[model samples]
Target: MLRQSSRFVVNRASAALVGRGRRFSTDLPAETGGDSKFVDDWKKVIPNLEPPKTPSAYMKPRPQTPSTIPSKLTVNLVLPYDSALSAKEVDMVIVPASTGQMGVLPGHVATIAELKPGVLSVHEGNDVTKYFLSGGFAFVHANSITDIVAIEATPLDQIDIASVQKGLTEFQQKLNSASTDLEKAQAQIGVDVHSALNAALTG
Candidate 1:
């Protein structure tokens, strides 16, 4: 009886030690560095099976950093249905960010700015082209590349003053008469957009 009890205790201690080792191993993260450590382990277990490809494997390698910044800033402006500008080199661009108007030039720091309803201006020499953008985003890359994407964009000169004023007045009335929360929100958006449009044209 004594021998049996001692043997049972020894078995339980061995099982507890195995369970503790497994728990510690799972808690530790795999040291993958750059390459996959699991890839080697899988190959040992299943020699014929191929390892899955990682995201880095499919992505293009980034270009090496240049010693000096380029003179011109490459700008790509696109709309939903069209590419407004592509690979165009310019001296500067002024974007209407949510924070405020932001001027970007060559060697500008990498940034992503949320655009608001306002005017976007592209500068080349003394000539400047302006456009009214409804809303979008601007991406500034470290390699002197700037991308502007907008839902709706129109040339500043093309907007009709009479139409904008009419829309603003109509939306203002709707906002005042709005009963539901959704109606109020929609009317508010219209008013804000039209107001921005009027301000862009006049200012």
Candidate 2:
């Protein structure tokens, strides 16, 4: 009975030892089939990873500036049966056409027109002057050259006041001495012509 009791106690002790050994072996690398130490080392070395890339320079667009205005103008003046007058490019050139008065400026479109009896005012830098035209035609070109072909163009300073007055008196006398309707009408036209000439001279 004592020997049997001892044998049973020994067997129980052996079984407990074997179970502890199996639990310890299951935690080994070959039993777990993975390296826990290596995984831990990798976590310590790189907690989180990101892809690598090169940095670039930043650029911005620039603003634009405005342009400026022009200063000078050059043009030619031509007349029929007279010397052409050379002038600087100016603001305006007024002409008396048969239809009416015409005003021209730089960059004006090309045109051809007839002129009447009136004053032509030319405006330049700080100066304005007038020329009297009896009848004419004007041709404007791209370069602002105005060719004025005139039947008559008289400068105010060059007109003779005495001659105009004398002509007026003669035409008045002819109107007063007319003996027929036809003669009266002819004399009346002469009077009108002389009167207009006198007014132009005086003006």
| lDDT by residue (tens digit), candidate 2, 1-203 | 44554454465447747846422211233323233443444345444532122111111211111132223333444565665456556667788666667787755555777876667677887887766766667776544455666666667667777886887798789899999999899888667656766766666
Evaluated at residue 24, the lDDT of candidate 2 is 21
TM-score of 2: 0.49
Query: Considering every candidate listed, which one attains the maximal lDDT?
Result: 1
Clashes of 1: 0
How does residue 185 of candidate 1 score in lDDT?
100
TM-score, one value per model: 0.72, 0.49
TM-score of 1: 0.72
lDDT of each: 0.80, 0.58
Whole-model lDDT for model 2 versus the true structure?
Answer: 0.58
Error of 2 at 67 (Å): 16
Q: Itemize residue pairs with steric clashes in candidate 1.
A: none
Name the weakest run of 10 consecutive residues (lDDT summed) in model 2.
54-63
Q: Show model 2 residue runs off by greater than 4 Å.
A: 1-81, 172-196, 201-203
Worst 10 residues of 1 by lDDT: 22-31
Query: Residue 118 of model 1: what lDDT?
Result: 94
lDDT of 1: 0.80
